[model samples]
Target: MQTADALQLLLTPDDDAEPVLIDGLSIGAAARADTTDRKKDVTLEHFWDETGDPDDLEEQRWGVIAPEGAAGDRLIALIQPLIDARREAQGGHEVMIDRVPSAMSPEEAARWRKQHFDVSVELARDLPRYQLILGDLNEVPLALQQHQATDGFVGRLCFREERAYEAYVDKVLRWERARAEAAGGARFFTVHDRTAATTIGYRSLVQPAVAQLGRYKLDVADLGDQDEPSPDAFLEAVKRREPTVLFSISHGAGAPRGGWKTEGDQRDRQGAMSFGRDKLSGGDLGDAPFLPGGIWFMLACYGAGTPDVSAYWHWLERLKQSGHFGGQTQSVLAGLPQGDQRPFIARLPQTVLANPNGPLAVMGHVDLAWTYSFQERDTGRAMSRPSKFVEVVRATLETSRVGSSFRELLKASIVTNVELTSLYDDAERLGATPDPARLGHLWMLRQDLSGYVLLGDPAVRLPAMRRRLKKDAASAGEPGVRVHEVRAQAPLPAVGPAVAAERQAEDAPKLPPDMDIDDVERAIGKLLSGSPIKAVASEHDIEPKQLSALKEIYRKAGRAALGVK
Candidate 1:
């Protein structure tokens, strides 16, 4: 069976069977290794050198031990069973590993890693269906550096001291030996890439999206260097590139007031140089190129905000209206804190590229307040980007599936753990529950409601209910009959005087058929001596205007026909 089909079956399990087990170095395990009381000697400063820079110190700390409560633990717990079940159903395969000896001295660590890597490559040569994932137990690269590692091999060796190096070597040897013996049909390889703020940020936001979908594949490309390919270059390099959904993370901005004659605002620009027009106009956006047959996501802030100036809607609005993009495009996620763009940008690509459907939905905050948060108490969640990213993405995706529209999905997906309160809750506390009718009306006015749907409780099943109402309308030959269910309790009983008053009013004498306007007026004056205008209007089936007109007619003419007044 295909991987997608296998994964789906695994996710939606049968009633009778037990869930499958997924084994890996969980984020939680990594955290525990990093934080045990046994690591007291590993000071925050020990990882640094005479330069007194904390960068290297932080990297060494993370490399040695994982943080407490890493969000990756929760994610792995959620998806491991599904992966295991899928593998089991697909005629279970074994994973092979080449164990590297850690009993060797510090000088031999590199050689040990190289030997294992060669062995893993040899084993992988025969299996075309199998994929390899590799990791270096020692010499953590700068990109992977969470805080900062020492300056060089000499720094790291000195930092490790005497017993530290031996202990690490022993740990690596044991881990590799155990993995190699547990030989499966597949071979496990490790590749190390440095982590940047942007990549880390993107990972956090995309995790929720991935877990929410339950069954999907992800292809991650780290865009860390400014010197690397620009967004346009990456867009052009897509080969066999018929993706149904596309998402991008970059700096964005709005146009200035004086057309192209002035420098445009730097508010939302995602690092791309802007120079076409002096003031930057929507006209430039209209001319901007876009990919065909894919939805786009702009993780940058203010990219999709209202079009006060020409540049506001030129990019986002044009992309949606252009008919080339599939479902939706532009910045659906919120911006980063204090105008930092890394986290939001990191998640956009992860979310869009993972789903073959090409991002039918994009969920994110519009402001920096929502996108920025710390992973651990110290060293800034900003520094350990991926862990934070994984948390946000997972939360967003879970929320997105529960609602129909991006906003609703975002509101639903708003992650509110015991530790973190959601922005939606804050808005609610401030009394900002937007009128659902008004929201629907606005969407209708925009005429972009086809791809957009409200994200809310699935139990409501409004669309199905609406369809039933439509069917009833069609069958009854009534074009506009609306059928809906609303819960209401019986009203309270009327008070004693109110009840008596209602009875008296009901039993009052009827008006004379031959009475003129003057006679009727006299009767009303006598009956309603101190009653208010509201009571008079309620008693008669006429409006205030009709009552006034009758009163005027009575004053002008005598009661000649009835002869009472």
Candidate 2:
């Protein structure tokens, strides 16, 4: 065997950038069971209606479904731009969910699908895929974005309530339009809470990912240091700044057994990112939101709603097969008979997107959040993995595809990990030396891959780059504030932006309690007038430049106060 291929079988625990399919579905999905034909006589139009009239299947592919509801009605209008784009690209082999009974047996009901549909064995990045799943959170299939279901599917871009749905969708459309014509930074805000065990990796992974995004020329703001002033202060910061992208890493509030399906529980727990031990739930934002429409990627447990049982049943079984079970079942595979095993309440993303002033979209963990999505263990060191979230953003901004490329990449990562465990199980039986790294990596990768979900529309396009006045190269680098270009190159490419400078965590800045410019200036004036620059800096416990700036500002204040103008 080739050394690289052999190394992967034992240690790397990832497919060498090549996609592997077992039976149209991923190898892990295929291993669970045979195709059962759950729904009978499927067609290209299951998600759309063709009876209204059409020219060709291509033209007809642009489904304009009017699902009834104030929010649903608004969703259609907001996504009309995407629909029109799809209608324009209506040629070549398209993807649709349908059954080819001929492949299985000749006796199945004489196939009612009027048009010929070929089931492609590949995950389509550009297929105009969509599903308008109406009903409660439990009624819908959370795996609507799962990789195994990528046969003819992608993210459903679900709308739970017509009101919030309309509000967010319209907000997205307006943000895109306004951004394209105006000069503005695509600011991305990442808030982290470092106090919990679930979030101990703040320094290791979360902060690094934030820096990486900043290098993408996204005006990135990271607000999750250990000495955070207060929850109110953090919340106030979020309200004060209008960023284009918001990414958070922390503990999400969750429902215990009693409150699992309650409205209050759903509103408070499912999407709220931790503020130390507490959280700021969607309801906390109140009716008038300070967020002015943009994308939000929240890395907390159940930031998106839990998926239907179908998403994780096979995965659970695989774990059980490999001699692991119980907790994984209770946490990840929880389901109810009526809801196809999906969670019973709408998540924080639902509320965030539904707000008339909330985000355009949100991507988050549907169940448990994990460090594996951002970092991996390598030779005793925790290394930053190529972020799956970064891939999702690329697919989102660059490709006009229907489903999440986020789910697809994560699936590949999971399948590779799962395959290793199965290999280890076989090795244990055969007395072959087992690679422990593969098994360790497996558990980390599985929950991460299955749990992430993109809420709001997957088809929502980022704002086009507005023309900007370029600063001279010498002054281009914003001081202290580091922002790299995030727009796919020409500037960044289809992937994420260039790697950022590794940010070393330093002790929090010790500023005065009552921060007044005038007070700072007085201190600067008193120290500098009687002492050297170093002495002034030492007395203020600040840098020389900082003292100098303060002195300059204080002198300017003195002139203004004296009415020298």
lDDT values, one for every candidate: 0.25, 0.44
**Deviating ranges (above 4 Å) for candidate 1:** 1-226, 237-241, 254-289, 306-365, 368-565
Q: For model 1, how does the per-residue alpha-carbon lDDT over 500-547 read when each residue is reduced to its tens digit?
A: 555544554443443333324632552345334433432232355655
> What TM-score does structure 2 among the candidates reach?
0.54
lDDT of 2 by residue, 429-526 (tens): 89885454544454445546666655554444444431222234554475644458776546433221111111111222434453444435544655
Best by TM-score: 2
Error of 2 at 190 (Å): 5.9
Output the worst ten-in-a-row residue range by lDDT, candidate 1.
461-470
